[model samples]
Target: MTIEVRVPTLGESVTEATVATWFKKPGDTVAVDEMLCELETDKVTVEVPAPAAGTLSDIVAAEGETVGVDALLANIAEGEGAAPAPKAEAPKQEAPAASGGGAGKSIDVMVPTLGESVTEATVATWFKSVGDSVEQDEMLCELETDKVSVEVPAPAAGVLAEIVAAEGATVDASAKLAVITSGGAAPKAAPEANAQAADGKAYTATTPGKDVEDAPSAKKAMAEAGISRDQVTGTGRDGRVMKEDVAKAVSSASAAPKASAPAAAPRAPSPAEDAAREERVKMTRLRQTIARRLKDAQNTAAILTTYNEVDMTEVMALRNTYKDQFEKKHGVRMGFMSFFTKACCHALKEVPEVNAEIDGTDIVYKNFVHMGVAAGTPQGLVVPVIRDADQMSFAEIEKAIAEKGRRARDGKLSMAEMQGGTFTISNGGVYGSLMSSPILNPPQSGILGMHKIQDRPMVINGEIKIRPMMYLALSYDHRIVDGKGAVTFLVRVKEALEDPRRLLMDL
Candidate 1:
């Protein structure tokens, strides 16, 4: 019987993938659930497994060919066609004493599936070293992708035999990371360690016969501190050097200089001296992705910014009155974010174009508001989405914002939580940014920038008075959102915030 192989469903927003590699060729005997091919999409790598024990009969999609969901990839012929290959190898397996005596089965430790749009990852740390015994499902290493950190667990209980991809190396999804000999005992001492000890030389635990590379961040830190790698004892997996190690080394080095050397006379350094002191560090994967996407938005969109000011007297007064009660009731503090979120939702209803996106040759209007709240983390800036914000109450909005913000800072957000935003709100106010134009988050037509609120003199009712004022900037894609729509959106937000009663009345 012949069975057809088809592409599985890719994740949300992914439509197609390219055949990256074929593990099996035509007429190759394959077991059920054996990996037959790998597909690479813009976001993640997917492996296609064989449906049954069979012979691969044909390849309909060759490597490097693009295929959509449910497209034919190959075919399998079950039954007699796959029988002969195993019988031919029977003689070699018959010698059980030679093959099984104190030897265990070797299993490959592969990189786990990364989250959406993540193709590669850096080996962040290894929790186990070569010859270390581990249990099945024990975490062996952690891989840092552009989005999140993924922990790779052992596939079977074993002693790790080799490290194929060491710390500081970049590896693609499903690539071999290490080898584990299932059921194998850990050695008392490695042969190389004994030999090096006898020769009066120190040995570092790493892959045999290969030099372990130091992390790029560590290298840059070392250069700036004027310390060599030999001075720091690495605490990372397999004795890999890390940035934290360099920091400790620098701390120790600083104390020595203070104790042993006399204070130097102050003088301006020469250009040559300045040049020698500079250190270069490579950009991280998250930073690179942010740079690429920001540049792409600039290159593709007709971006423009509109500005307006808001009187915070009403919103601030309203919040101060009910904050204690609201926090007690909802178990979340009432903050400016909920007010801004509600204001934006109210504004989006009036200026729908600001909440819409441009597809190929068409404009897609979203009736529901999925607000993206831009947050800054130590790694980089990220936008986590709150679905259907138009229907959420002030308390709900505050709780959602607080939860997502906490997760974003800790790098625990999932891909689904970060996608599907209809409009964005970036609050530079927390960082004391007075007034700055914000950039539009791509696909979403508009982004609202909220700046710091300060007391300003304003003429209200023909009298000069001090009032809390904030500058609001609305950045939009001119291709889909007209200038008038952008201006109207900002005005609506200003009105809602200035008179909090307007929001409650749905005005």
Candidate 2:
């Protein structure tokens, strides 16, 4: 029997995708649910997995080719031929352990505990395979948890002896991942070295005995940088190549001419030269989704931004007065976000249109507020909603925001937490953004942008005084919210924030 592998649904509003890379080629055996290829869409890259354990028989779609959702990617031949091949190759792979001397010195690679709550993670990608050379501290694989992606490093230099957990496999912390044959010799350098060695002198050109005793990391680095082991000055035990030496060589390779001839006039390179200097990498699924959604929000919505300035003096004073006590009582710091969130909730209640969305030809008004708080992560910006934020106490709001922000960056947020936000608040002020009009998180009619505070002269009762002021921007869907309503909403938020007691009074 032959099984057809098809691309899965990419995401909401994502219909088509480009084949980014194929992990398995024709004649290669694959296990059930094993990832075979990656499909890159405008929103995210989706992994196509094997339908069954079999041998890859054909590739219907090639790399860089576009295909719609559920389109056939390849075929796999199952039954006898496919099933017996892996068994046949198993002995050949294990043969090295029996034949090689000092094989028992291999280092066991185990999964490290991620956190108090996390115990298991999925193997995201494997950088090196069995028999592939690796260096100590070099990334060997990536582990994906509910909240974050962690890179597993090589424990010792040598060959990747075995793989206990394949990509997409879930394992507990402290579980064996793979093994590295420490003290084993590296594989011969690429054919490029042999070409350089054609003159015979190339082999012995580097310091005598330098390449022989070089650390696996240094040797791997030397090969990648195209520098002979002898050329780099060793800084490791017994004058062996260190990872840093390889890095220096790589850095030097780019600025080689400049370093050698500092007085020479620099010349512009041609298109070919420029192309050689550039690098291309496939975007991750998270980044693609962020780009697509943000672009779609701009094209589909009638976005109008309204600005206002808020006096932060009162809010700061309140926080300064009670932050210590608040932290001690609630076990979470009193942050400015909770205050702003409360103010937005109150304003949203008064001005309901800002909390509404356009559903096809009709207006959808949400009675309950699921406030989305924008958090920046290494991957991209993610908004996790605090359900019924309007009903949450200040201490509860502070705790939820802190937990969600931490989980968002760690990649632990659930899909439910990111869905169905009635309103959003983005604080670019944390990043020193003086002012910015934030875009709407689609379907939601409004987003409040908070910016950096600065001391400016202001009149408070006929006297000029320096006060901390912050610029606020509210970007809303003009289709749903009117200019008057947008302005009125901003004013209400400002009033609530400037007078923090209003939040307590629900005024």
Candidate 3:
């Protein structure tokens, strides 16, 4: 009998992947669920595993070649002789059973399927150590991907015999992470003591003892922030300090007044000290993708920026008047984003070219608006799309923005939440940017950039008056959007924002 190995689903919006590595070659004897090859996609790396115990008969997808979902990767020829290979090594496995107090089968703990568009992850933390007993379906470790943190659970109740992938290791889907010896006896000491021993650290009489070990990522974050362990509180299992706790501590410390003198200013490094001072760190996958896409947009589009300023006096007053009542009724705070999103949706209807995209030689016009809101996180910049924004009410728009923004910051957004955007809006005002020409998020014709509102004197009705004003920048692709259309879109947005009633009336 012959078994075919095919690529699994690559998640939402992911259609293809490039073969990265092949662990087994043709004619190699393989066990069921053994990893055979790896595929690298734009968002993640996927590992293809053997479906049955057999001899790998053929390789269909070679390394560096791109293959689509459900594409043929390889084939296996099942033979009777293949099933007896493990039985022949029975004596080698008996030695462990004699010392460990039980004769049991060893099971491989493989990486689970990461949610939408994610293919690979970094081993963030291990909750269990080698020789520690684990319960079925109990969380053993956490994997950190570009989009979210995934908790990996144990496959079955057993003793963790070996840790194949350690902390900070990048692993693909279905790759072996650890080994569990089923029905093995628990060690003499507690799991905590075993963990400490494995890490080469011990509690002493002279030193202060801690309940749980600090997470590896948390320690790195504290070092980078110049913070001490005693300053930040732990929130993880058994009072272990996590990376997020250190970040919170750093943020709180920045807002407080310093009681001590400031440190000396950095001076120019001497030739001898240059090498020691400079550090080189590899770019993360998210950062690398951001760089590539931004450059690609610049190269492909005939980008042009049109600037217009809007009077924020009306919008600010309207928000302040109804904010309390609005929040009480809708359970969401009234923010400037909802106003901008609503105004943009109104403006997009007036100038459809700004909302359209170029598909090859043809221009594709979308009647509905999928608004992309650009958000910056610790990893990099990401744009989460709000579907059918044009049809949503103010309260719904506010709720969606709040939810997606929170998820984006926490790196919990899925790929589907980031795809299918017809237009994008980026508010650099939150970071105090006065004005910036935002780049186009490819395929989309335009992006609206919002800047910080400043109280400036304006001549209105031939009289000089102080008004809260903001500069709006519309960057559009000249190929699809004419200068007139781009200018019209910006003007409409400015008018709608200056008079909030215009958005209500759909003017």
Candidate 4:
């Protein structure tokens, strides 16, 4: 009756997750859709549910364990015609065992590197303290990176035994931040102690003013304890010390009564009670991810954006005339994205290089267009791809786009739905932006940015008059795609968008 559970796939590039919690314990009965445990991936937290009604028999994994996708998680005694359990690789308990962690044993937990190029983060604040009950997916602390404040969650539910890193400390990616145990020890004011050094310096092995003997070990211990030598109390002989001393110093300091977060900086936003009021809003998951990816993509890619303005006279007239009928027939309003998406698809089909990805040694050209439309939600920008845009009916495209967009705003889009796009289109014009030169999403050679429609003076039959003009920008990887290819691809998109009939006729 033992039904084995496994880690569901998280995202396209995600290979593993740190256990955040075991919501149900042994002998607990669970419903078919019940959340059995929580998982913290690099990007977000996800709940792993019980596939069927069952009695939880055992947790094959513990909190804080990093498990690969499809790894066995727990075993439940299925009720009534228990479906056959799916096969999984042997549980990764062996790896943790091999790495040397014993039951009830405590280990150092550190801040992980979020990306390849990111080096470190500043500890903005700690949410839990020593002896505090911690839960999986519960925010443990916040880290201020170069741009945003990121909420870091506890890998598993346990007693927070220590907070090694305090607010405002800039620590390396691998720096230790806190310690957890099955039950945290009560807060105790650490008594100062000194290690009699060979050089006769009384180095107090406690937080602040610690001496060191080996620089590497000191750095490593400091990295592991989330403390700098400047803040640790050294009591070694002649101010010379070791790693154990540093760890001891960190633990003692953490055991003390902690201070409350100081009132927000004078300049920090405060709530107002007047009309035209504003509220300080937290950056959402989508927004943070977007900001990180856009910045990272910019840093990694040699990007260049080409600009061109398109006359929307024909498309505008077509939409205005058929708008009511099209809505009545298709059950969706005619928006500018379909024309743009179709135009991008046409351009990509012609210049397959624009649809290609850069491998280390080769370029991968996609045969179909998985057009990514960046939907701007209250949470932020999320690009959900329209699978095989070339094959879908206009109504189908509208429905898919509508559904995906709704799900994105609702934070319901799965990791799979957000992935696998050959190219991206981010329309700044939706926010009524006059113009924008967007960046290329990594791996994709090109991205098309759309802007607002505005009336401007133009020449027509040797006379100046008002006309609706739209600015378009195409950002491309200059390394893989040449200037000519970029311009040609953009020109193709422009031509299709200008003459809406071309998109319908497959031109």
Model 4's number of clashes is 23
lDDT of 1 by residue, 1-507 (tens): 998999988878889999999998998887555678989888777888776666899999999999999999999988775445633223323222222435665566777767555778987666776667889999888777876667889988877666677666788765767766765455445323321222244434655223455665677778877877679878755567777888988888777845467879999999999877676666767778788888989988899999999999999999999999998999999999998999999989988989899899999999999999999875679999999999999999999999999998766787778888999999999999999988888988899999999999999999999999999999899998888888989999999999999999999
Off by over 4 Å in 4: 1-285
Number of the top-ranking candidate, with TM-score as the measure: 1
Predictions in order: lDDT: 0.80, 0.77, 0.81, 0.69
Q: What is the clash count for each candidate, in the order shown?
A: 1, 10, 2, 23
TM-score of each: 0.74, 0.57, 0.72, 0.51
Q: Worst 10-residue stretch by lDDT in candidate 1?
A: 190-199
Per-residue error at 481 for model 3, in Å?
1.5
Error of model 4, residue 142, in angstroms:
17
TM-score, cand. 3: 0.72
For residues 1-507, could you state the per-residue lDDT of candidate 3 as single tens digits?
889999998877899999999998887878667889878888766777778767888998899999998999999888775444644234436424633666766667788766546768877667776667789999888777765567789988977766677665788766777767777665444233322222344421111215354655576787788777789888876567878999999999999997897898989878878665443444555666788889999999999999999999999999999999999999999999999999999989889989999988898999999999999776678999999999999999999999998998766787668888999999999999999999999989999999999999999999999999999999999999999999999998899988899887879
Candidate 1 stretches with Cα past 4 Å from truth are 1-34, 37-46, 49-103, 115-118, 189-272
- Candidate 4 C-alpha lDDT tens digits along 123-230: 644555455566777877767554234567776666555556665456765566765553333323321322233245543322323222332345466766666666
lDDT of 3: 0.81
- What lDDT would candidate 1 get against the real structure? 0.80
Give per-residue CA lDDT, model 2, range 1-507, as digits (tens): 999998876667788999988988988887655668877766444667676767898999999999988889999998766655654234334424532543435456767544334557776556664566788899887776654567788867777666667655678765667766666553333212321121233322123344233443455556666666656776754455667878886787777665354576888889998776554433444566678889999999999999999999999999999999999999999999999999999999899999999989999889999999999875568899999998999999999999999898666776557877999999999999999989999989999999999999999999999999999999999998999999999999999989999998989
Candidate 4, lDDT over the whole model: 0.69
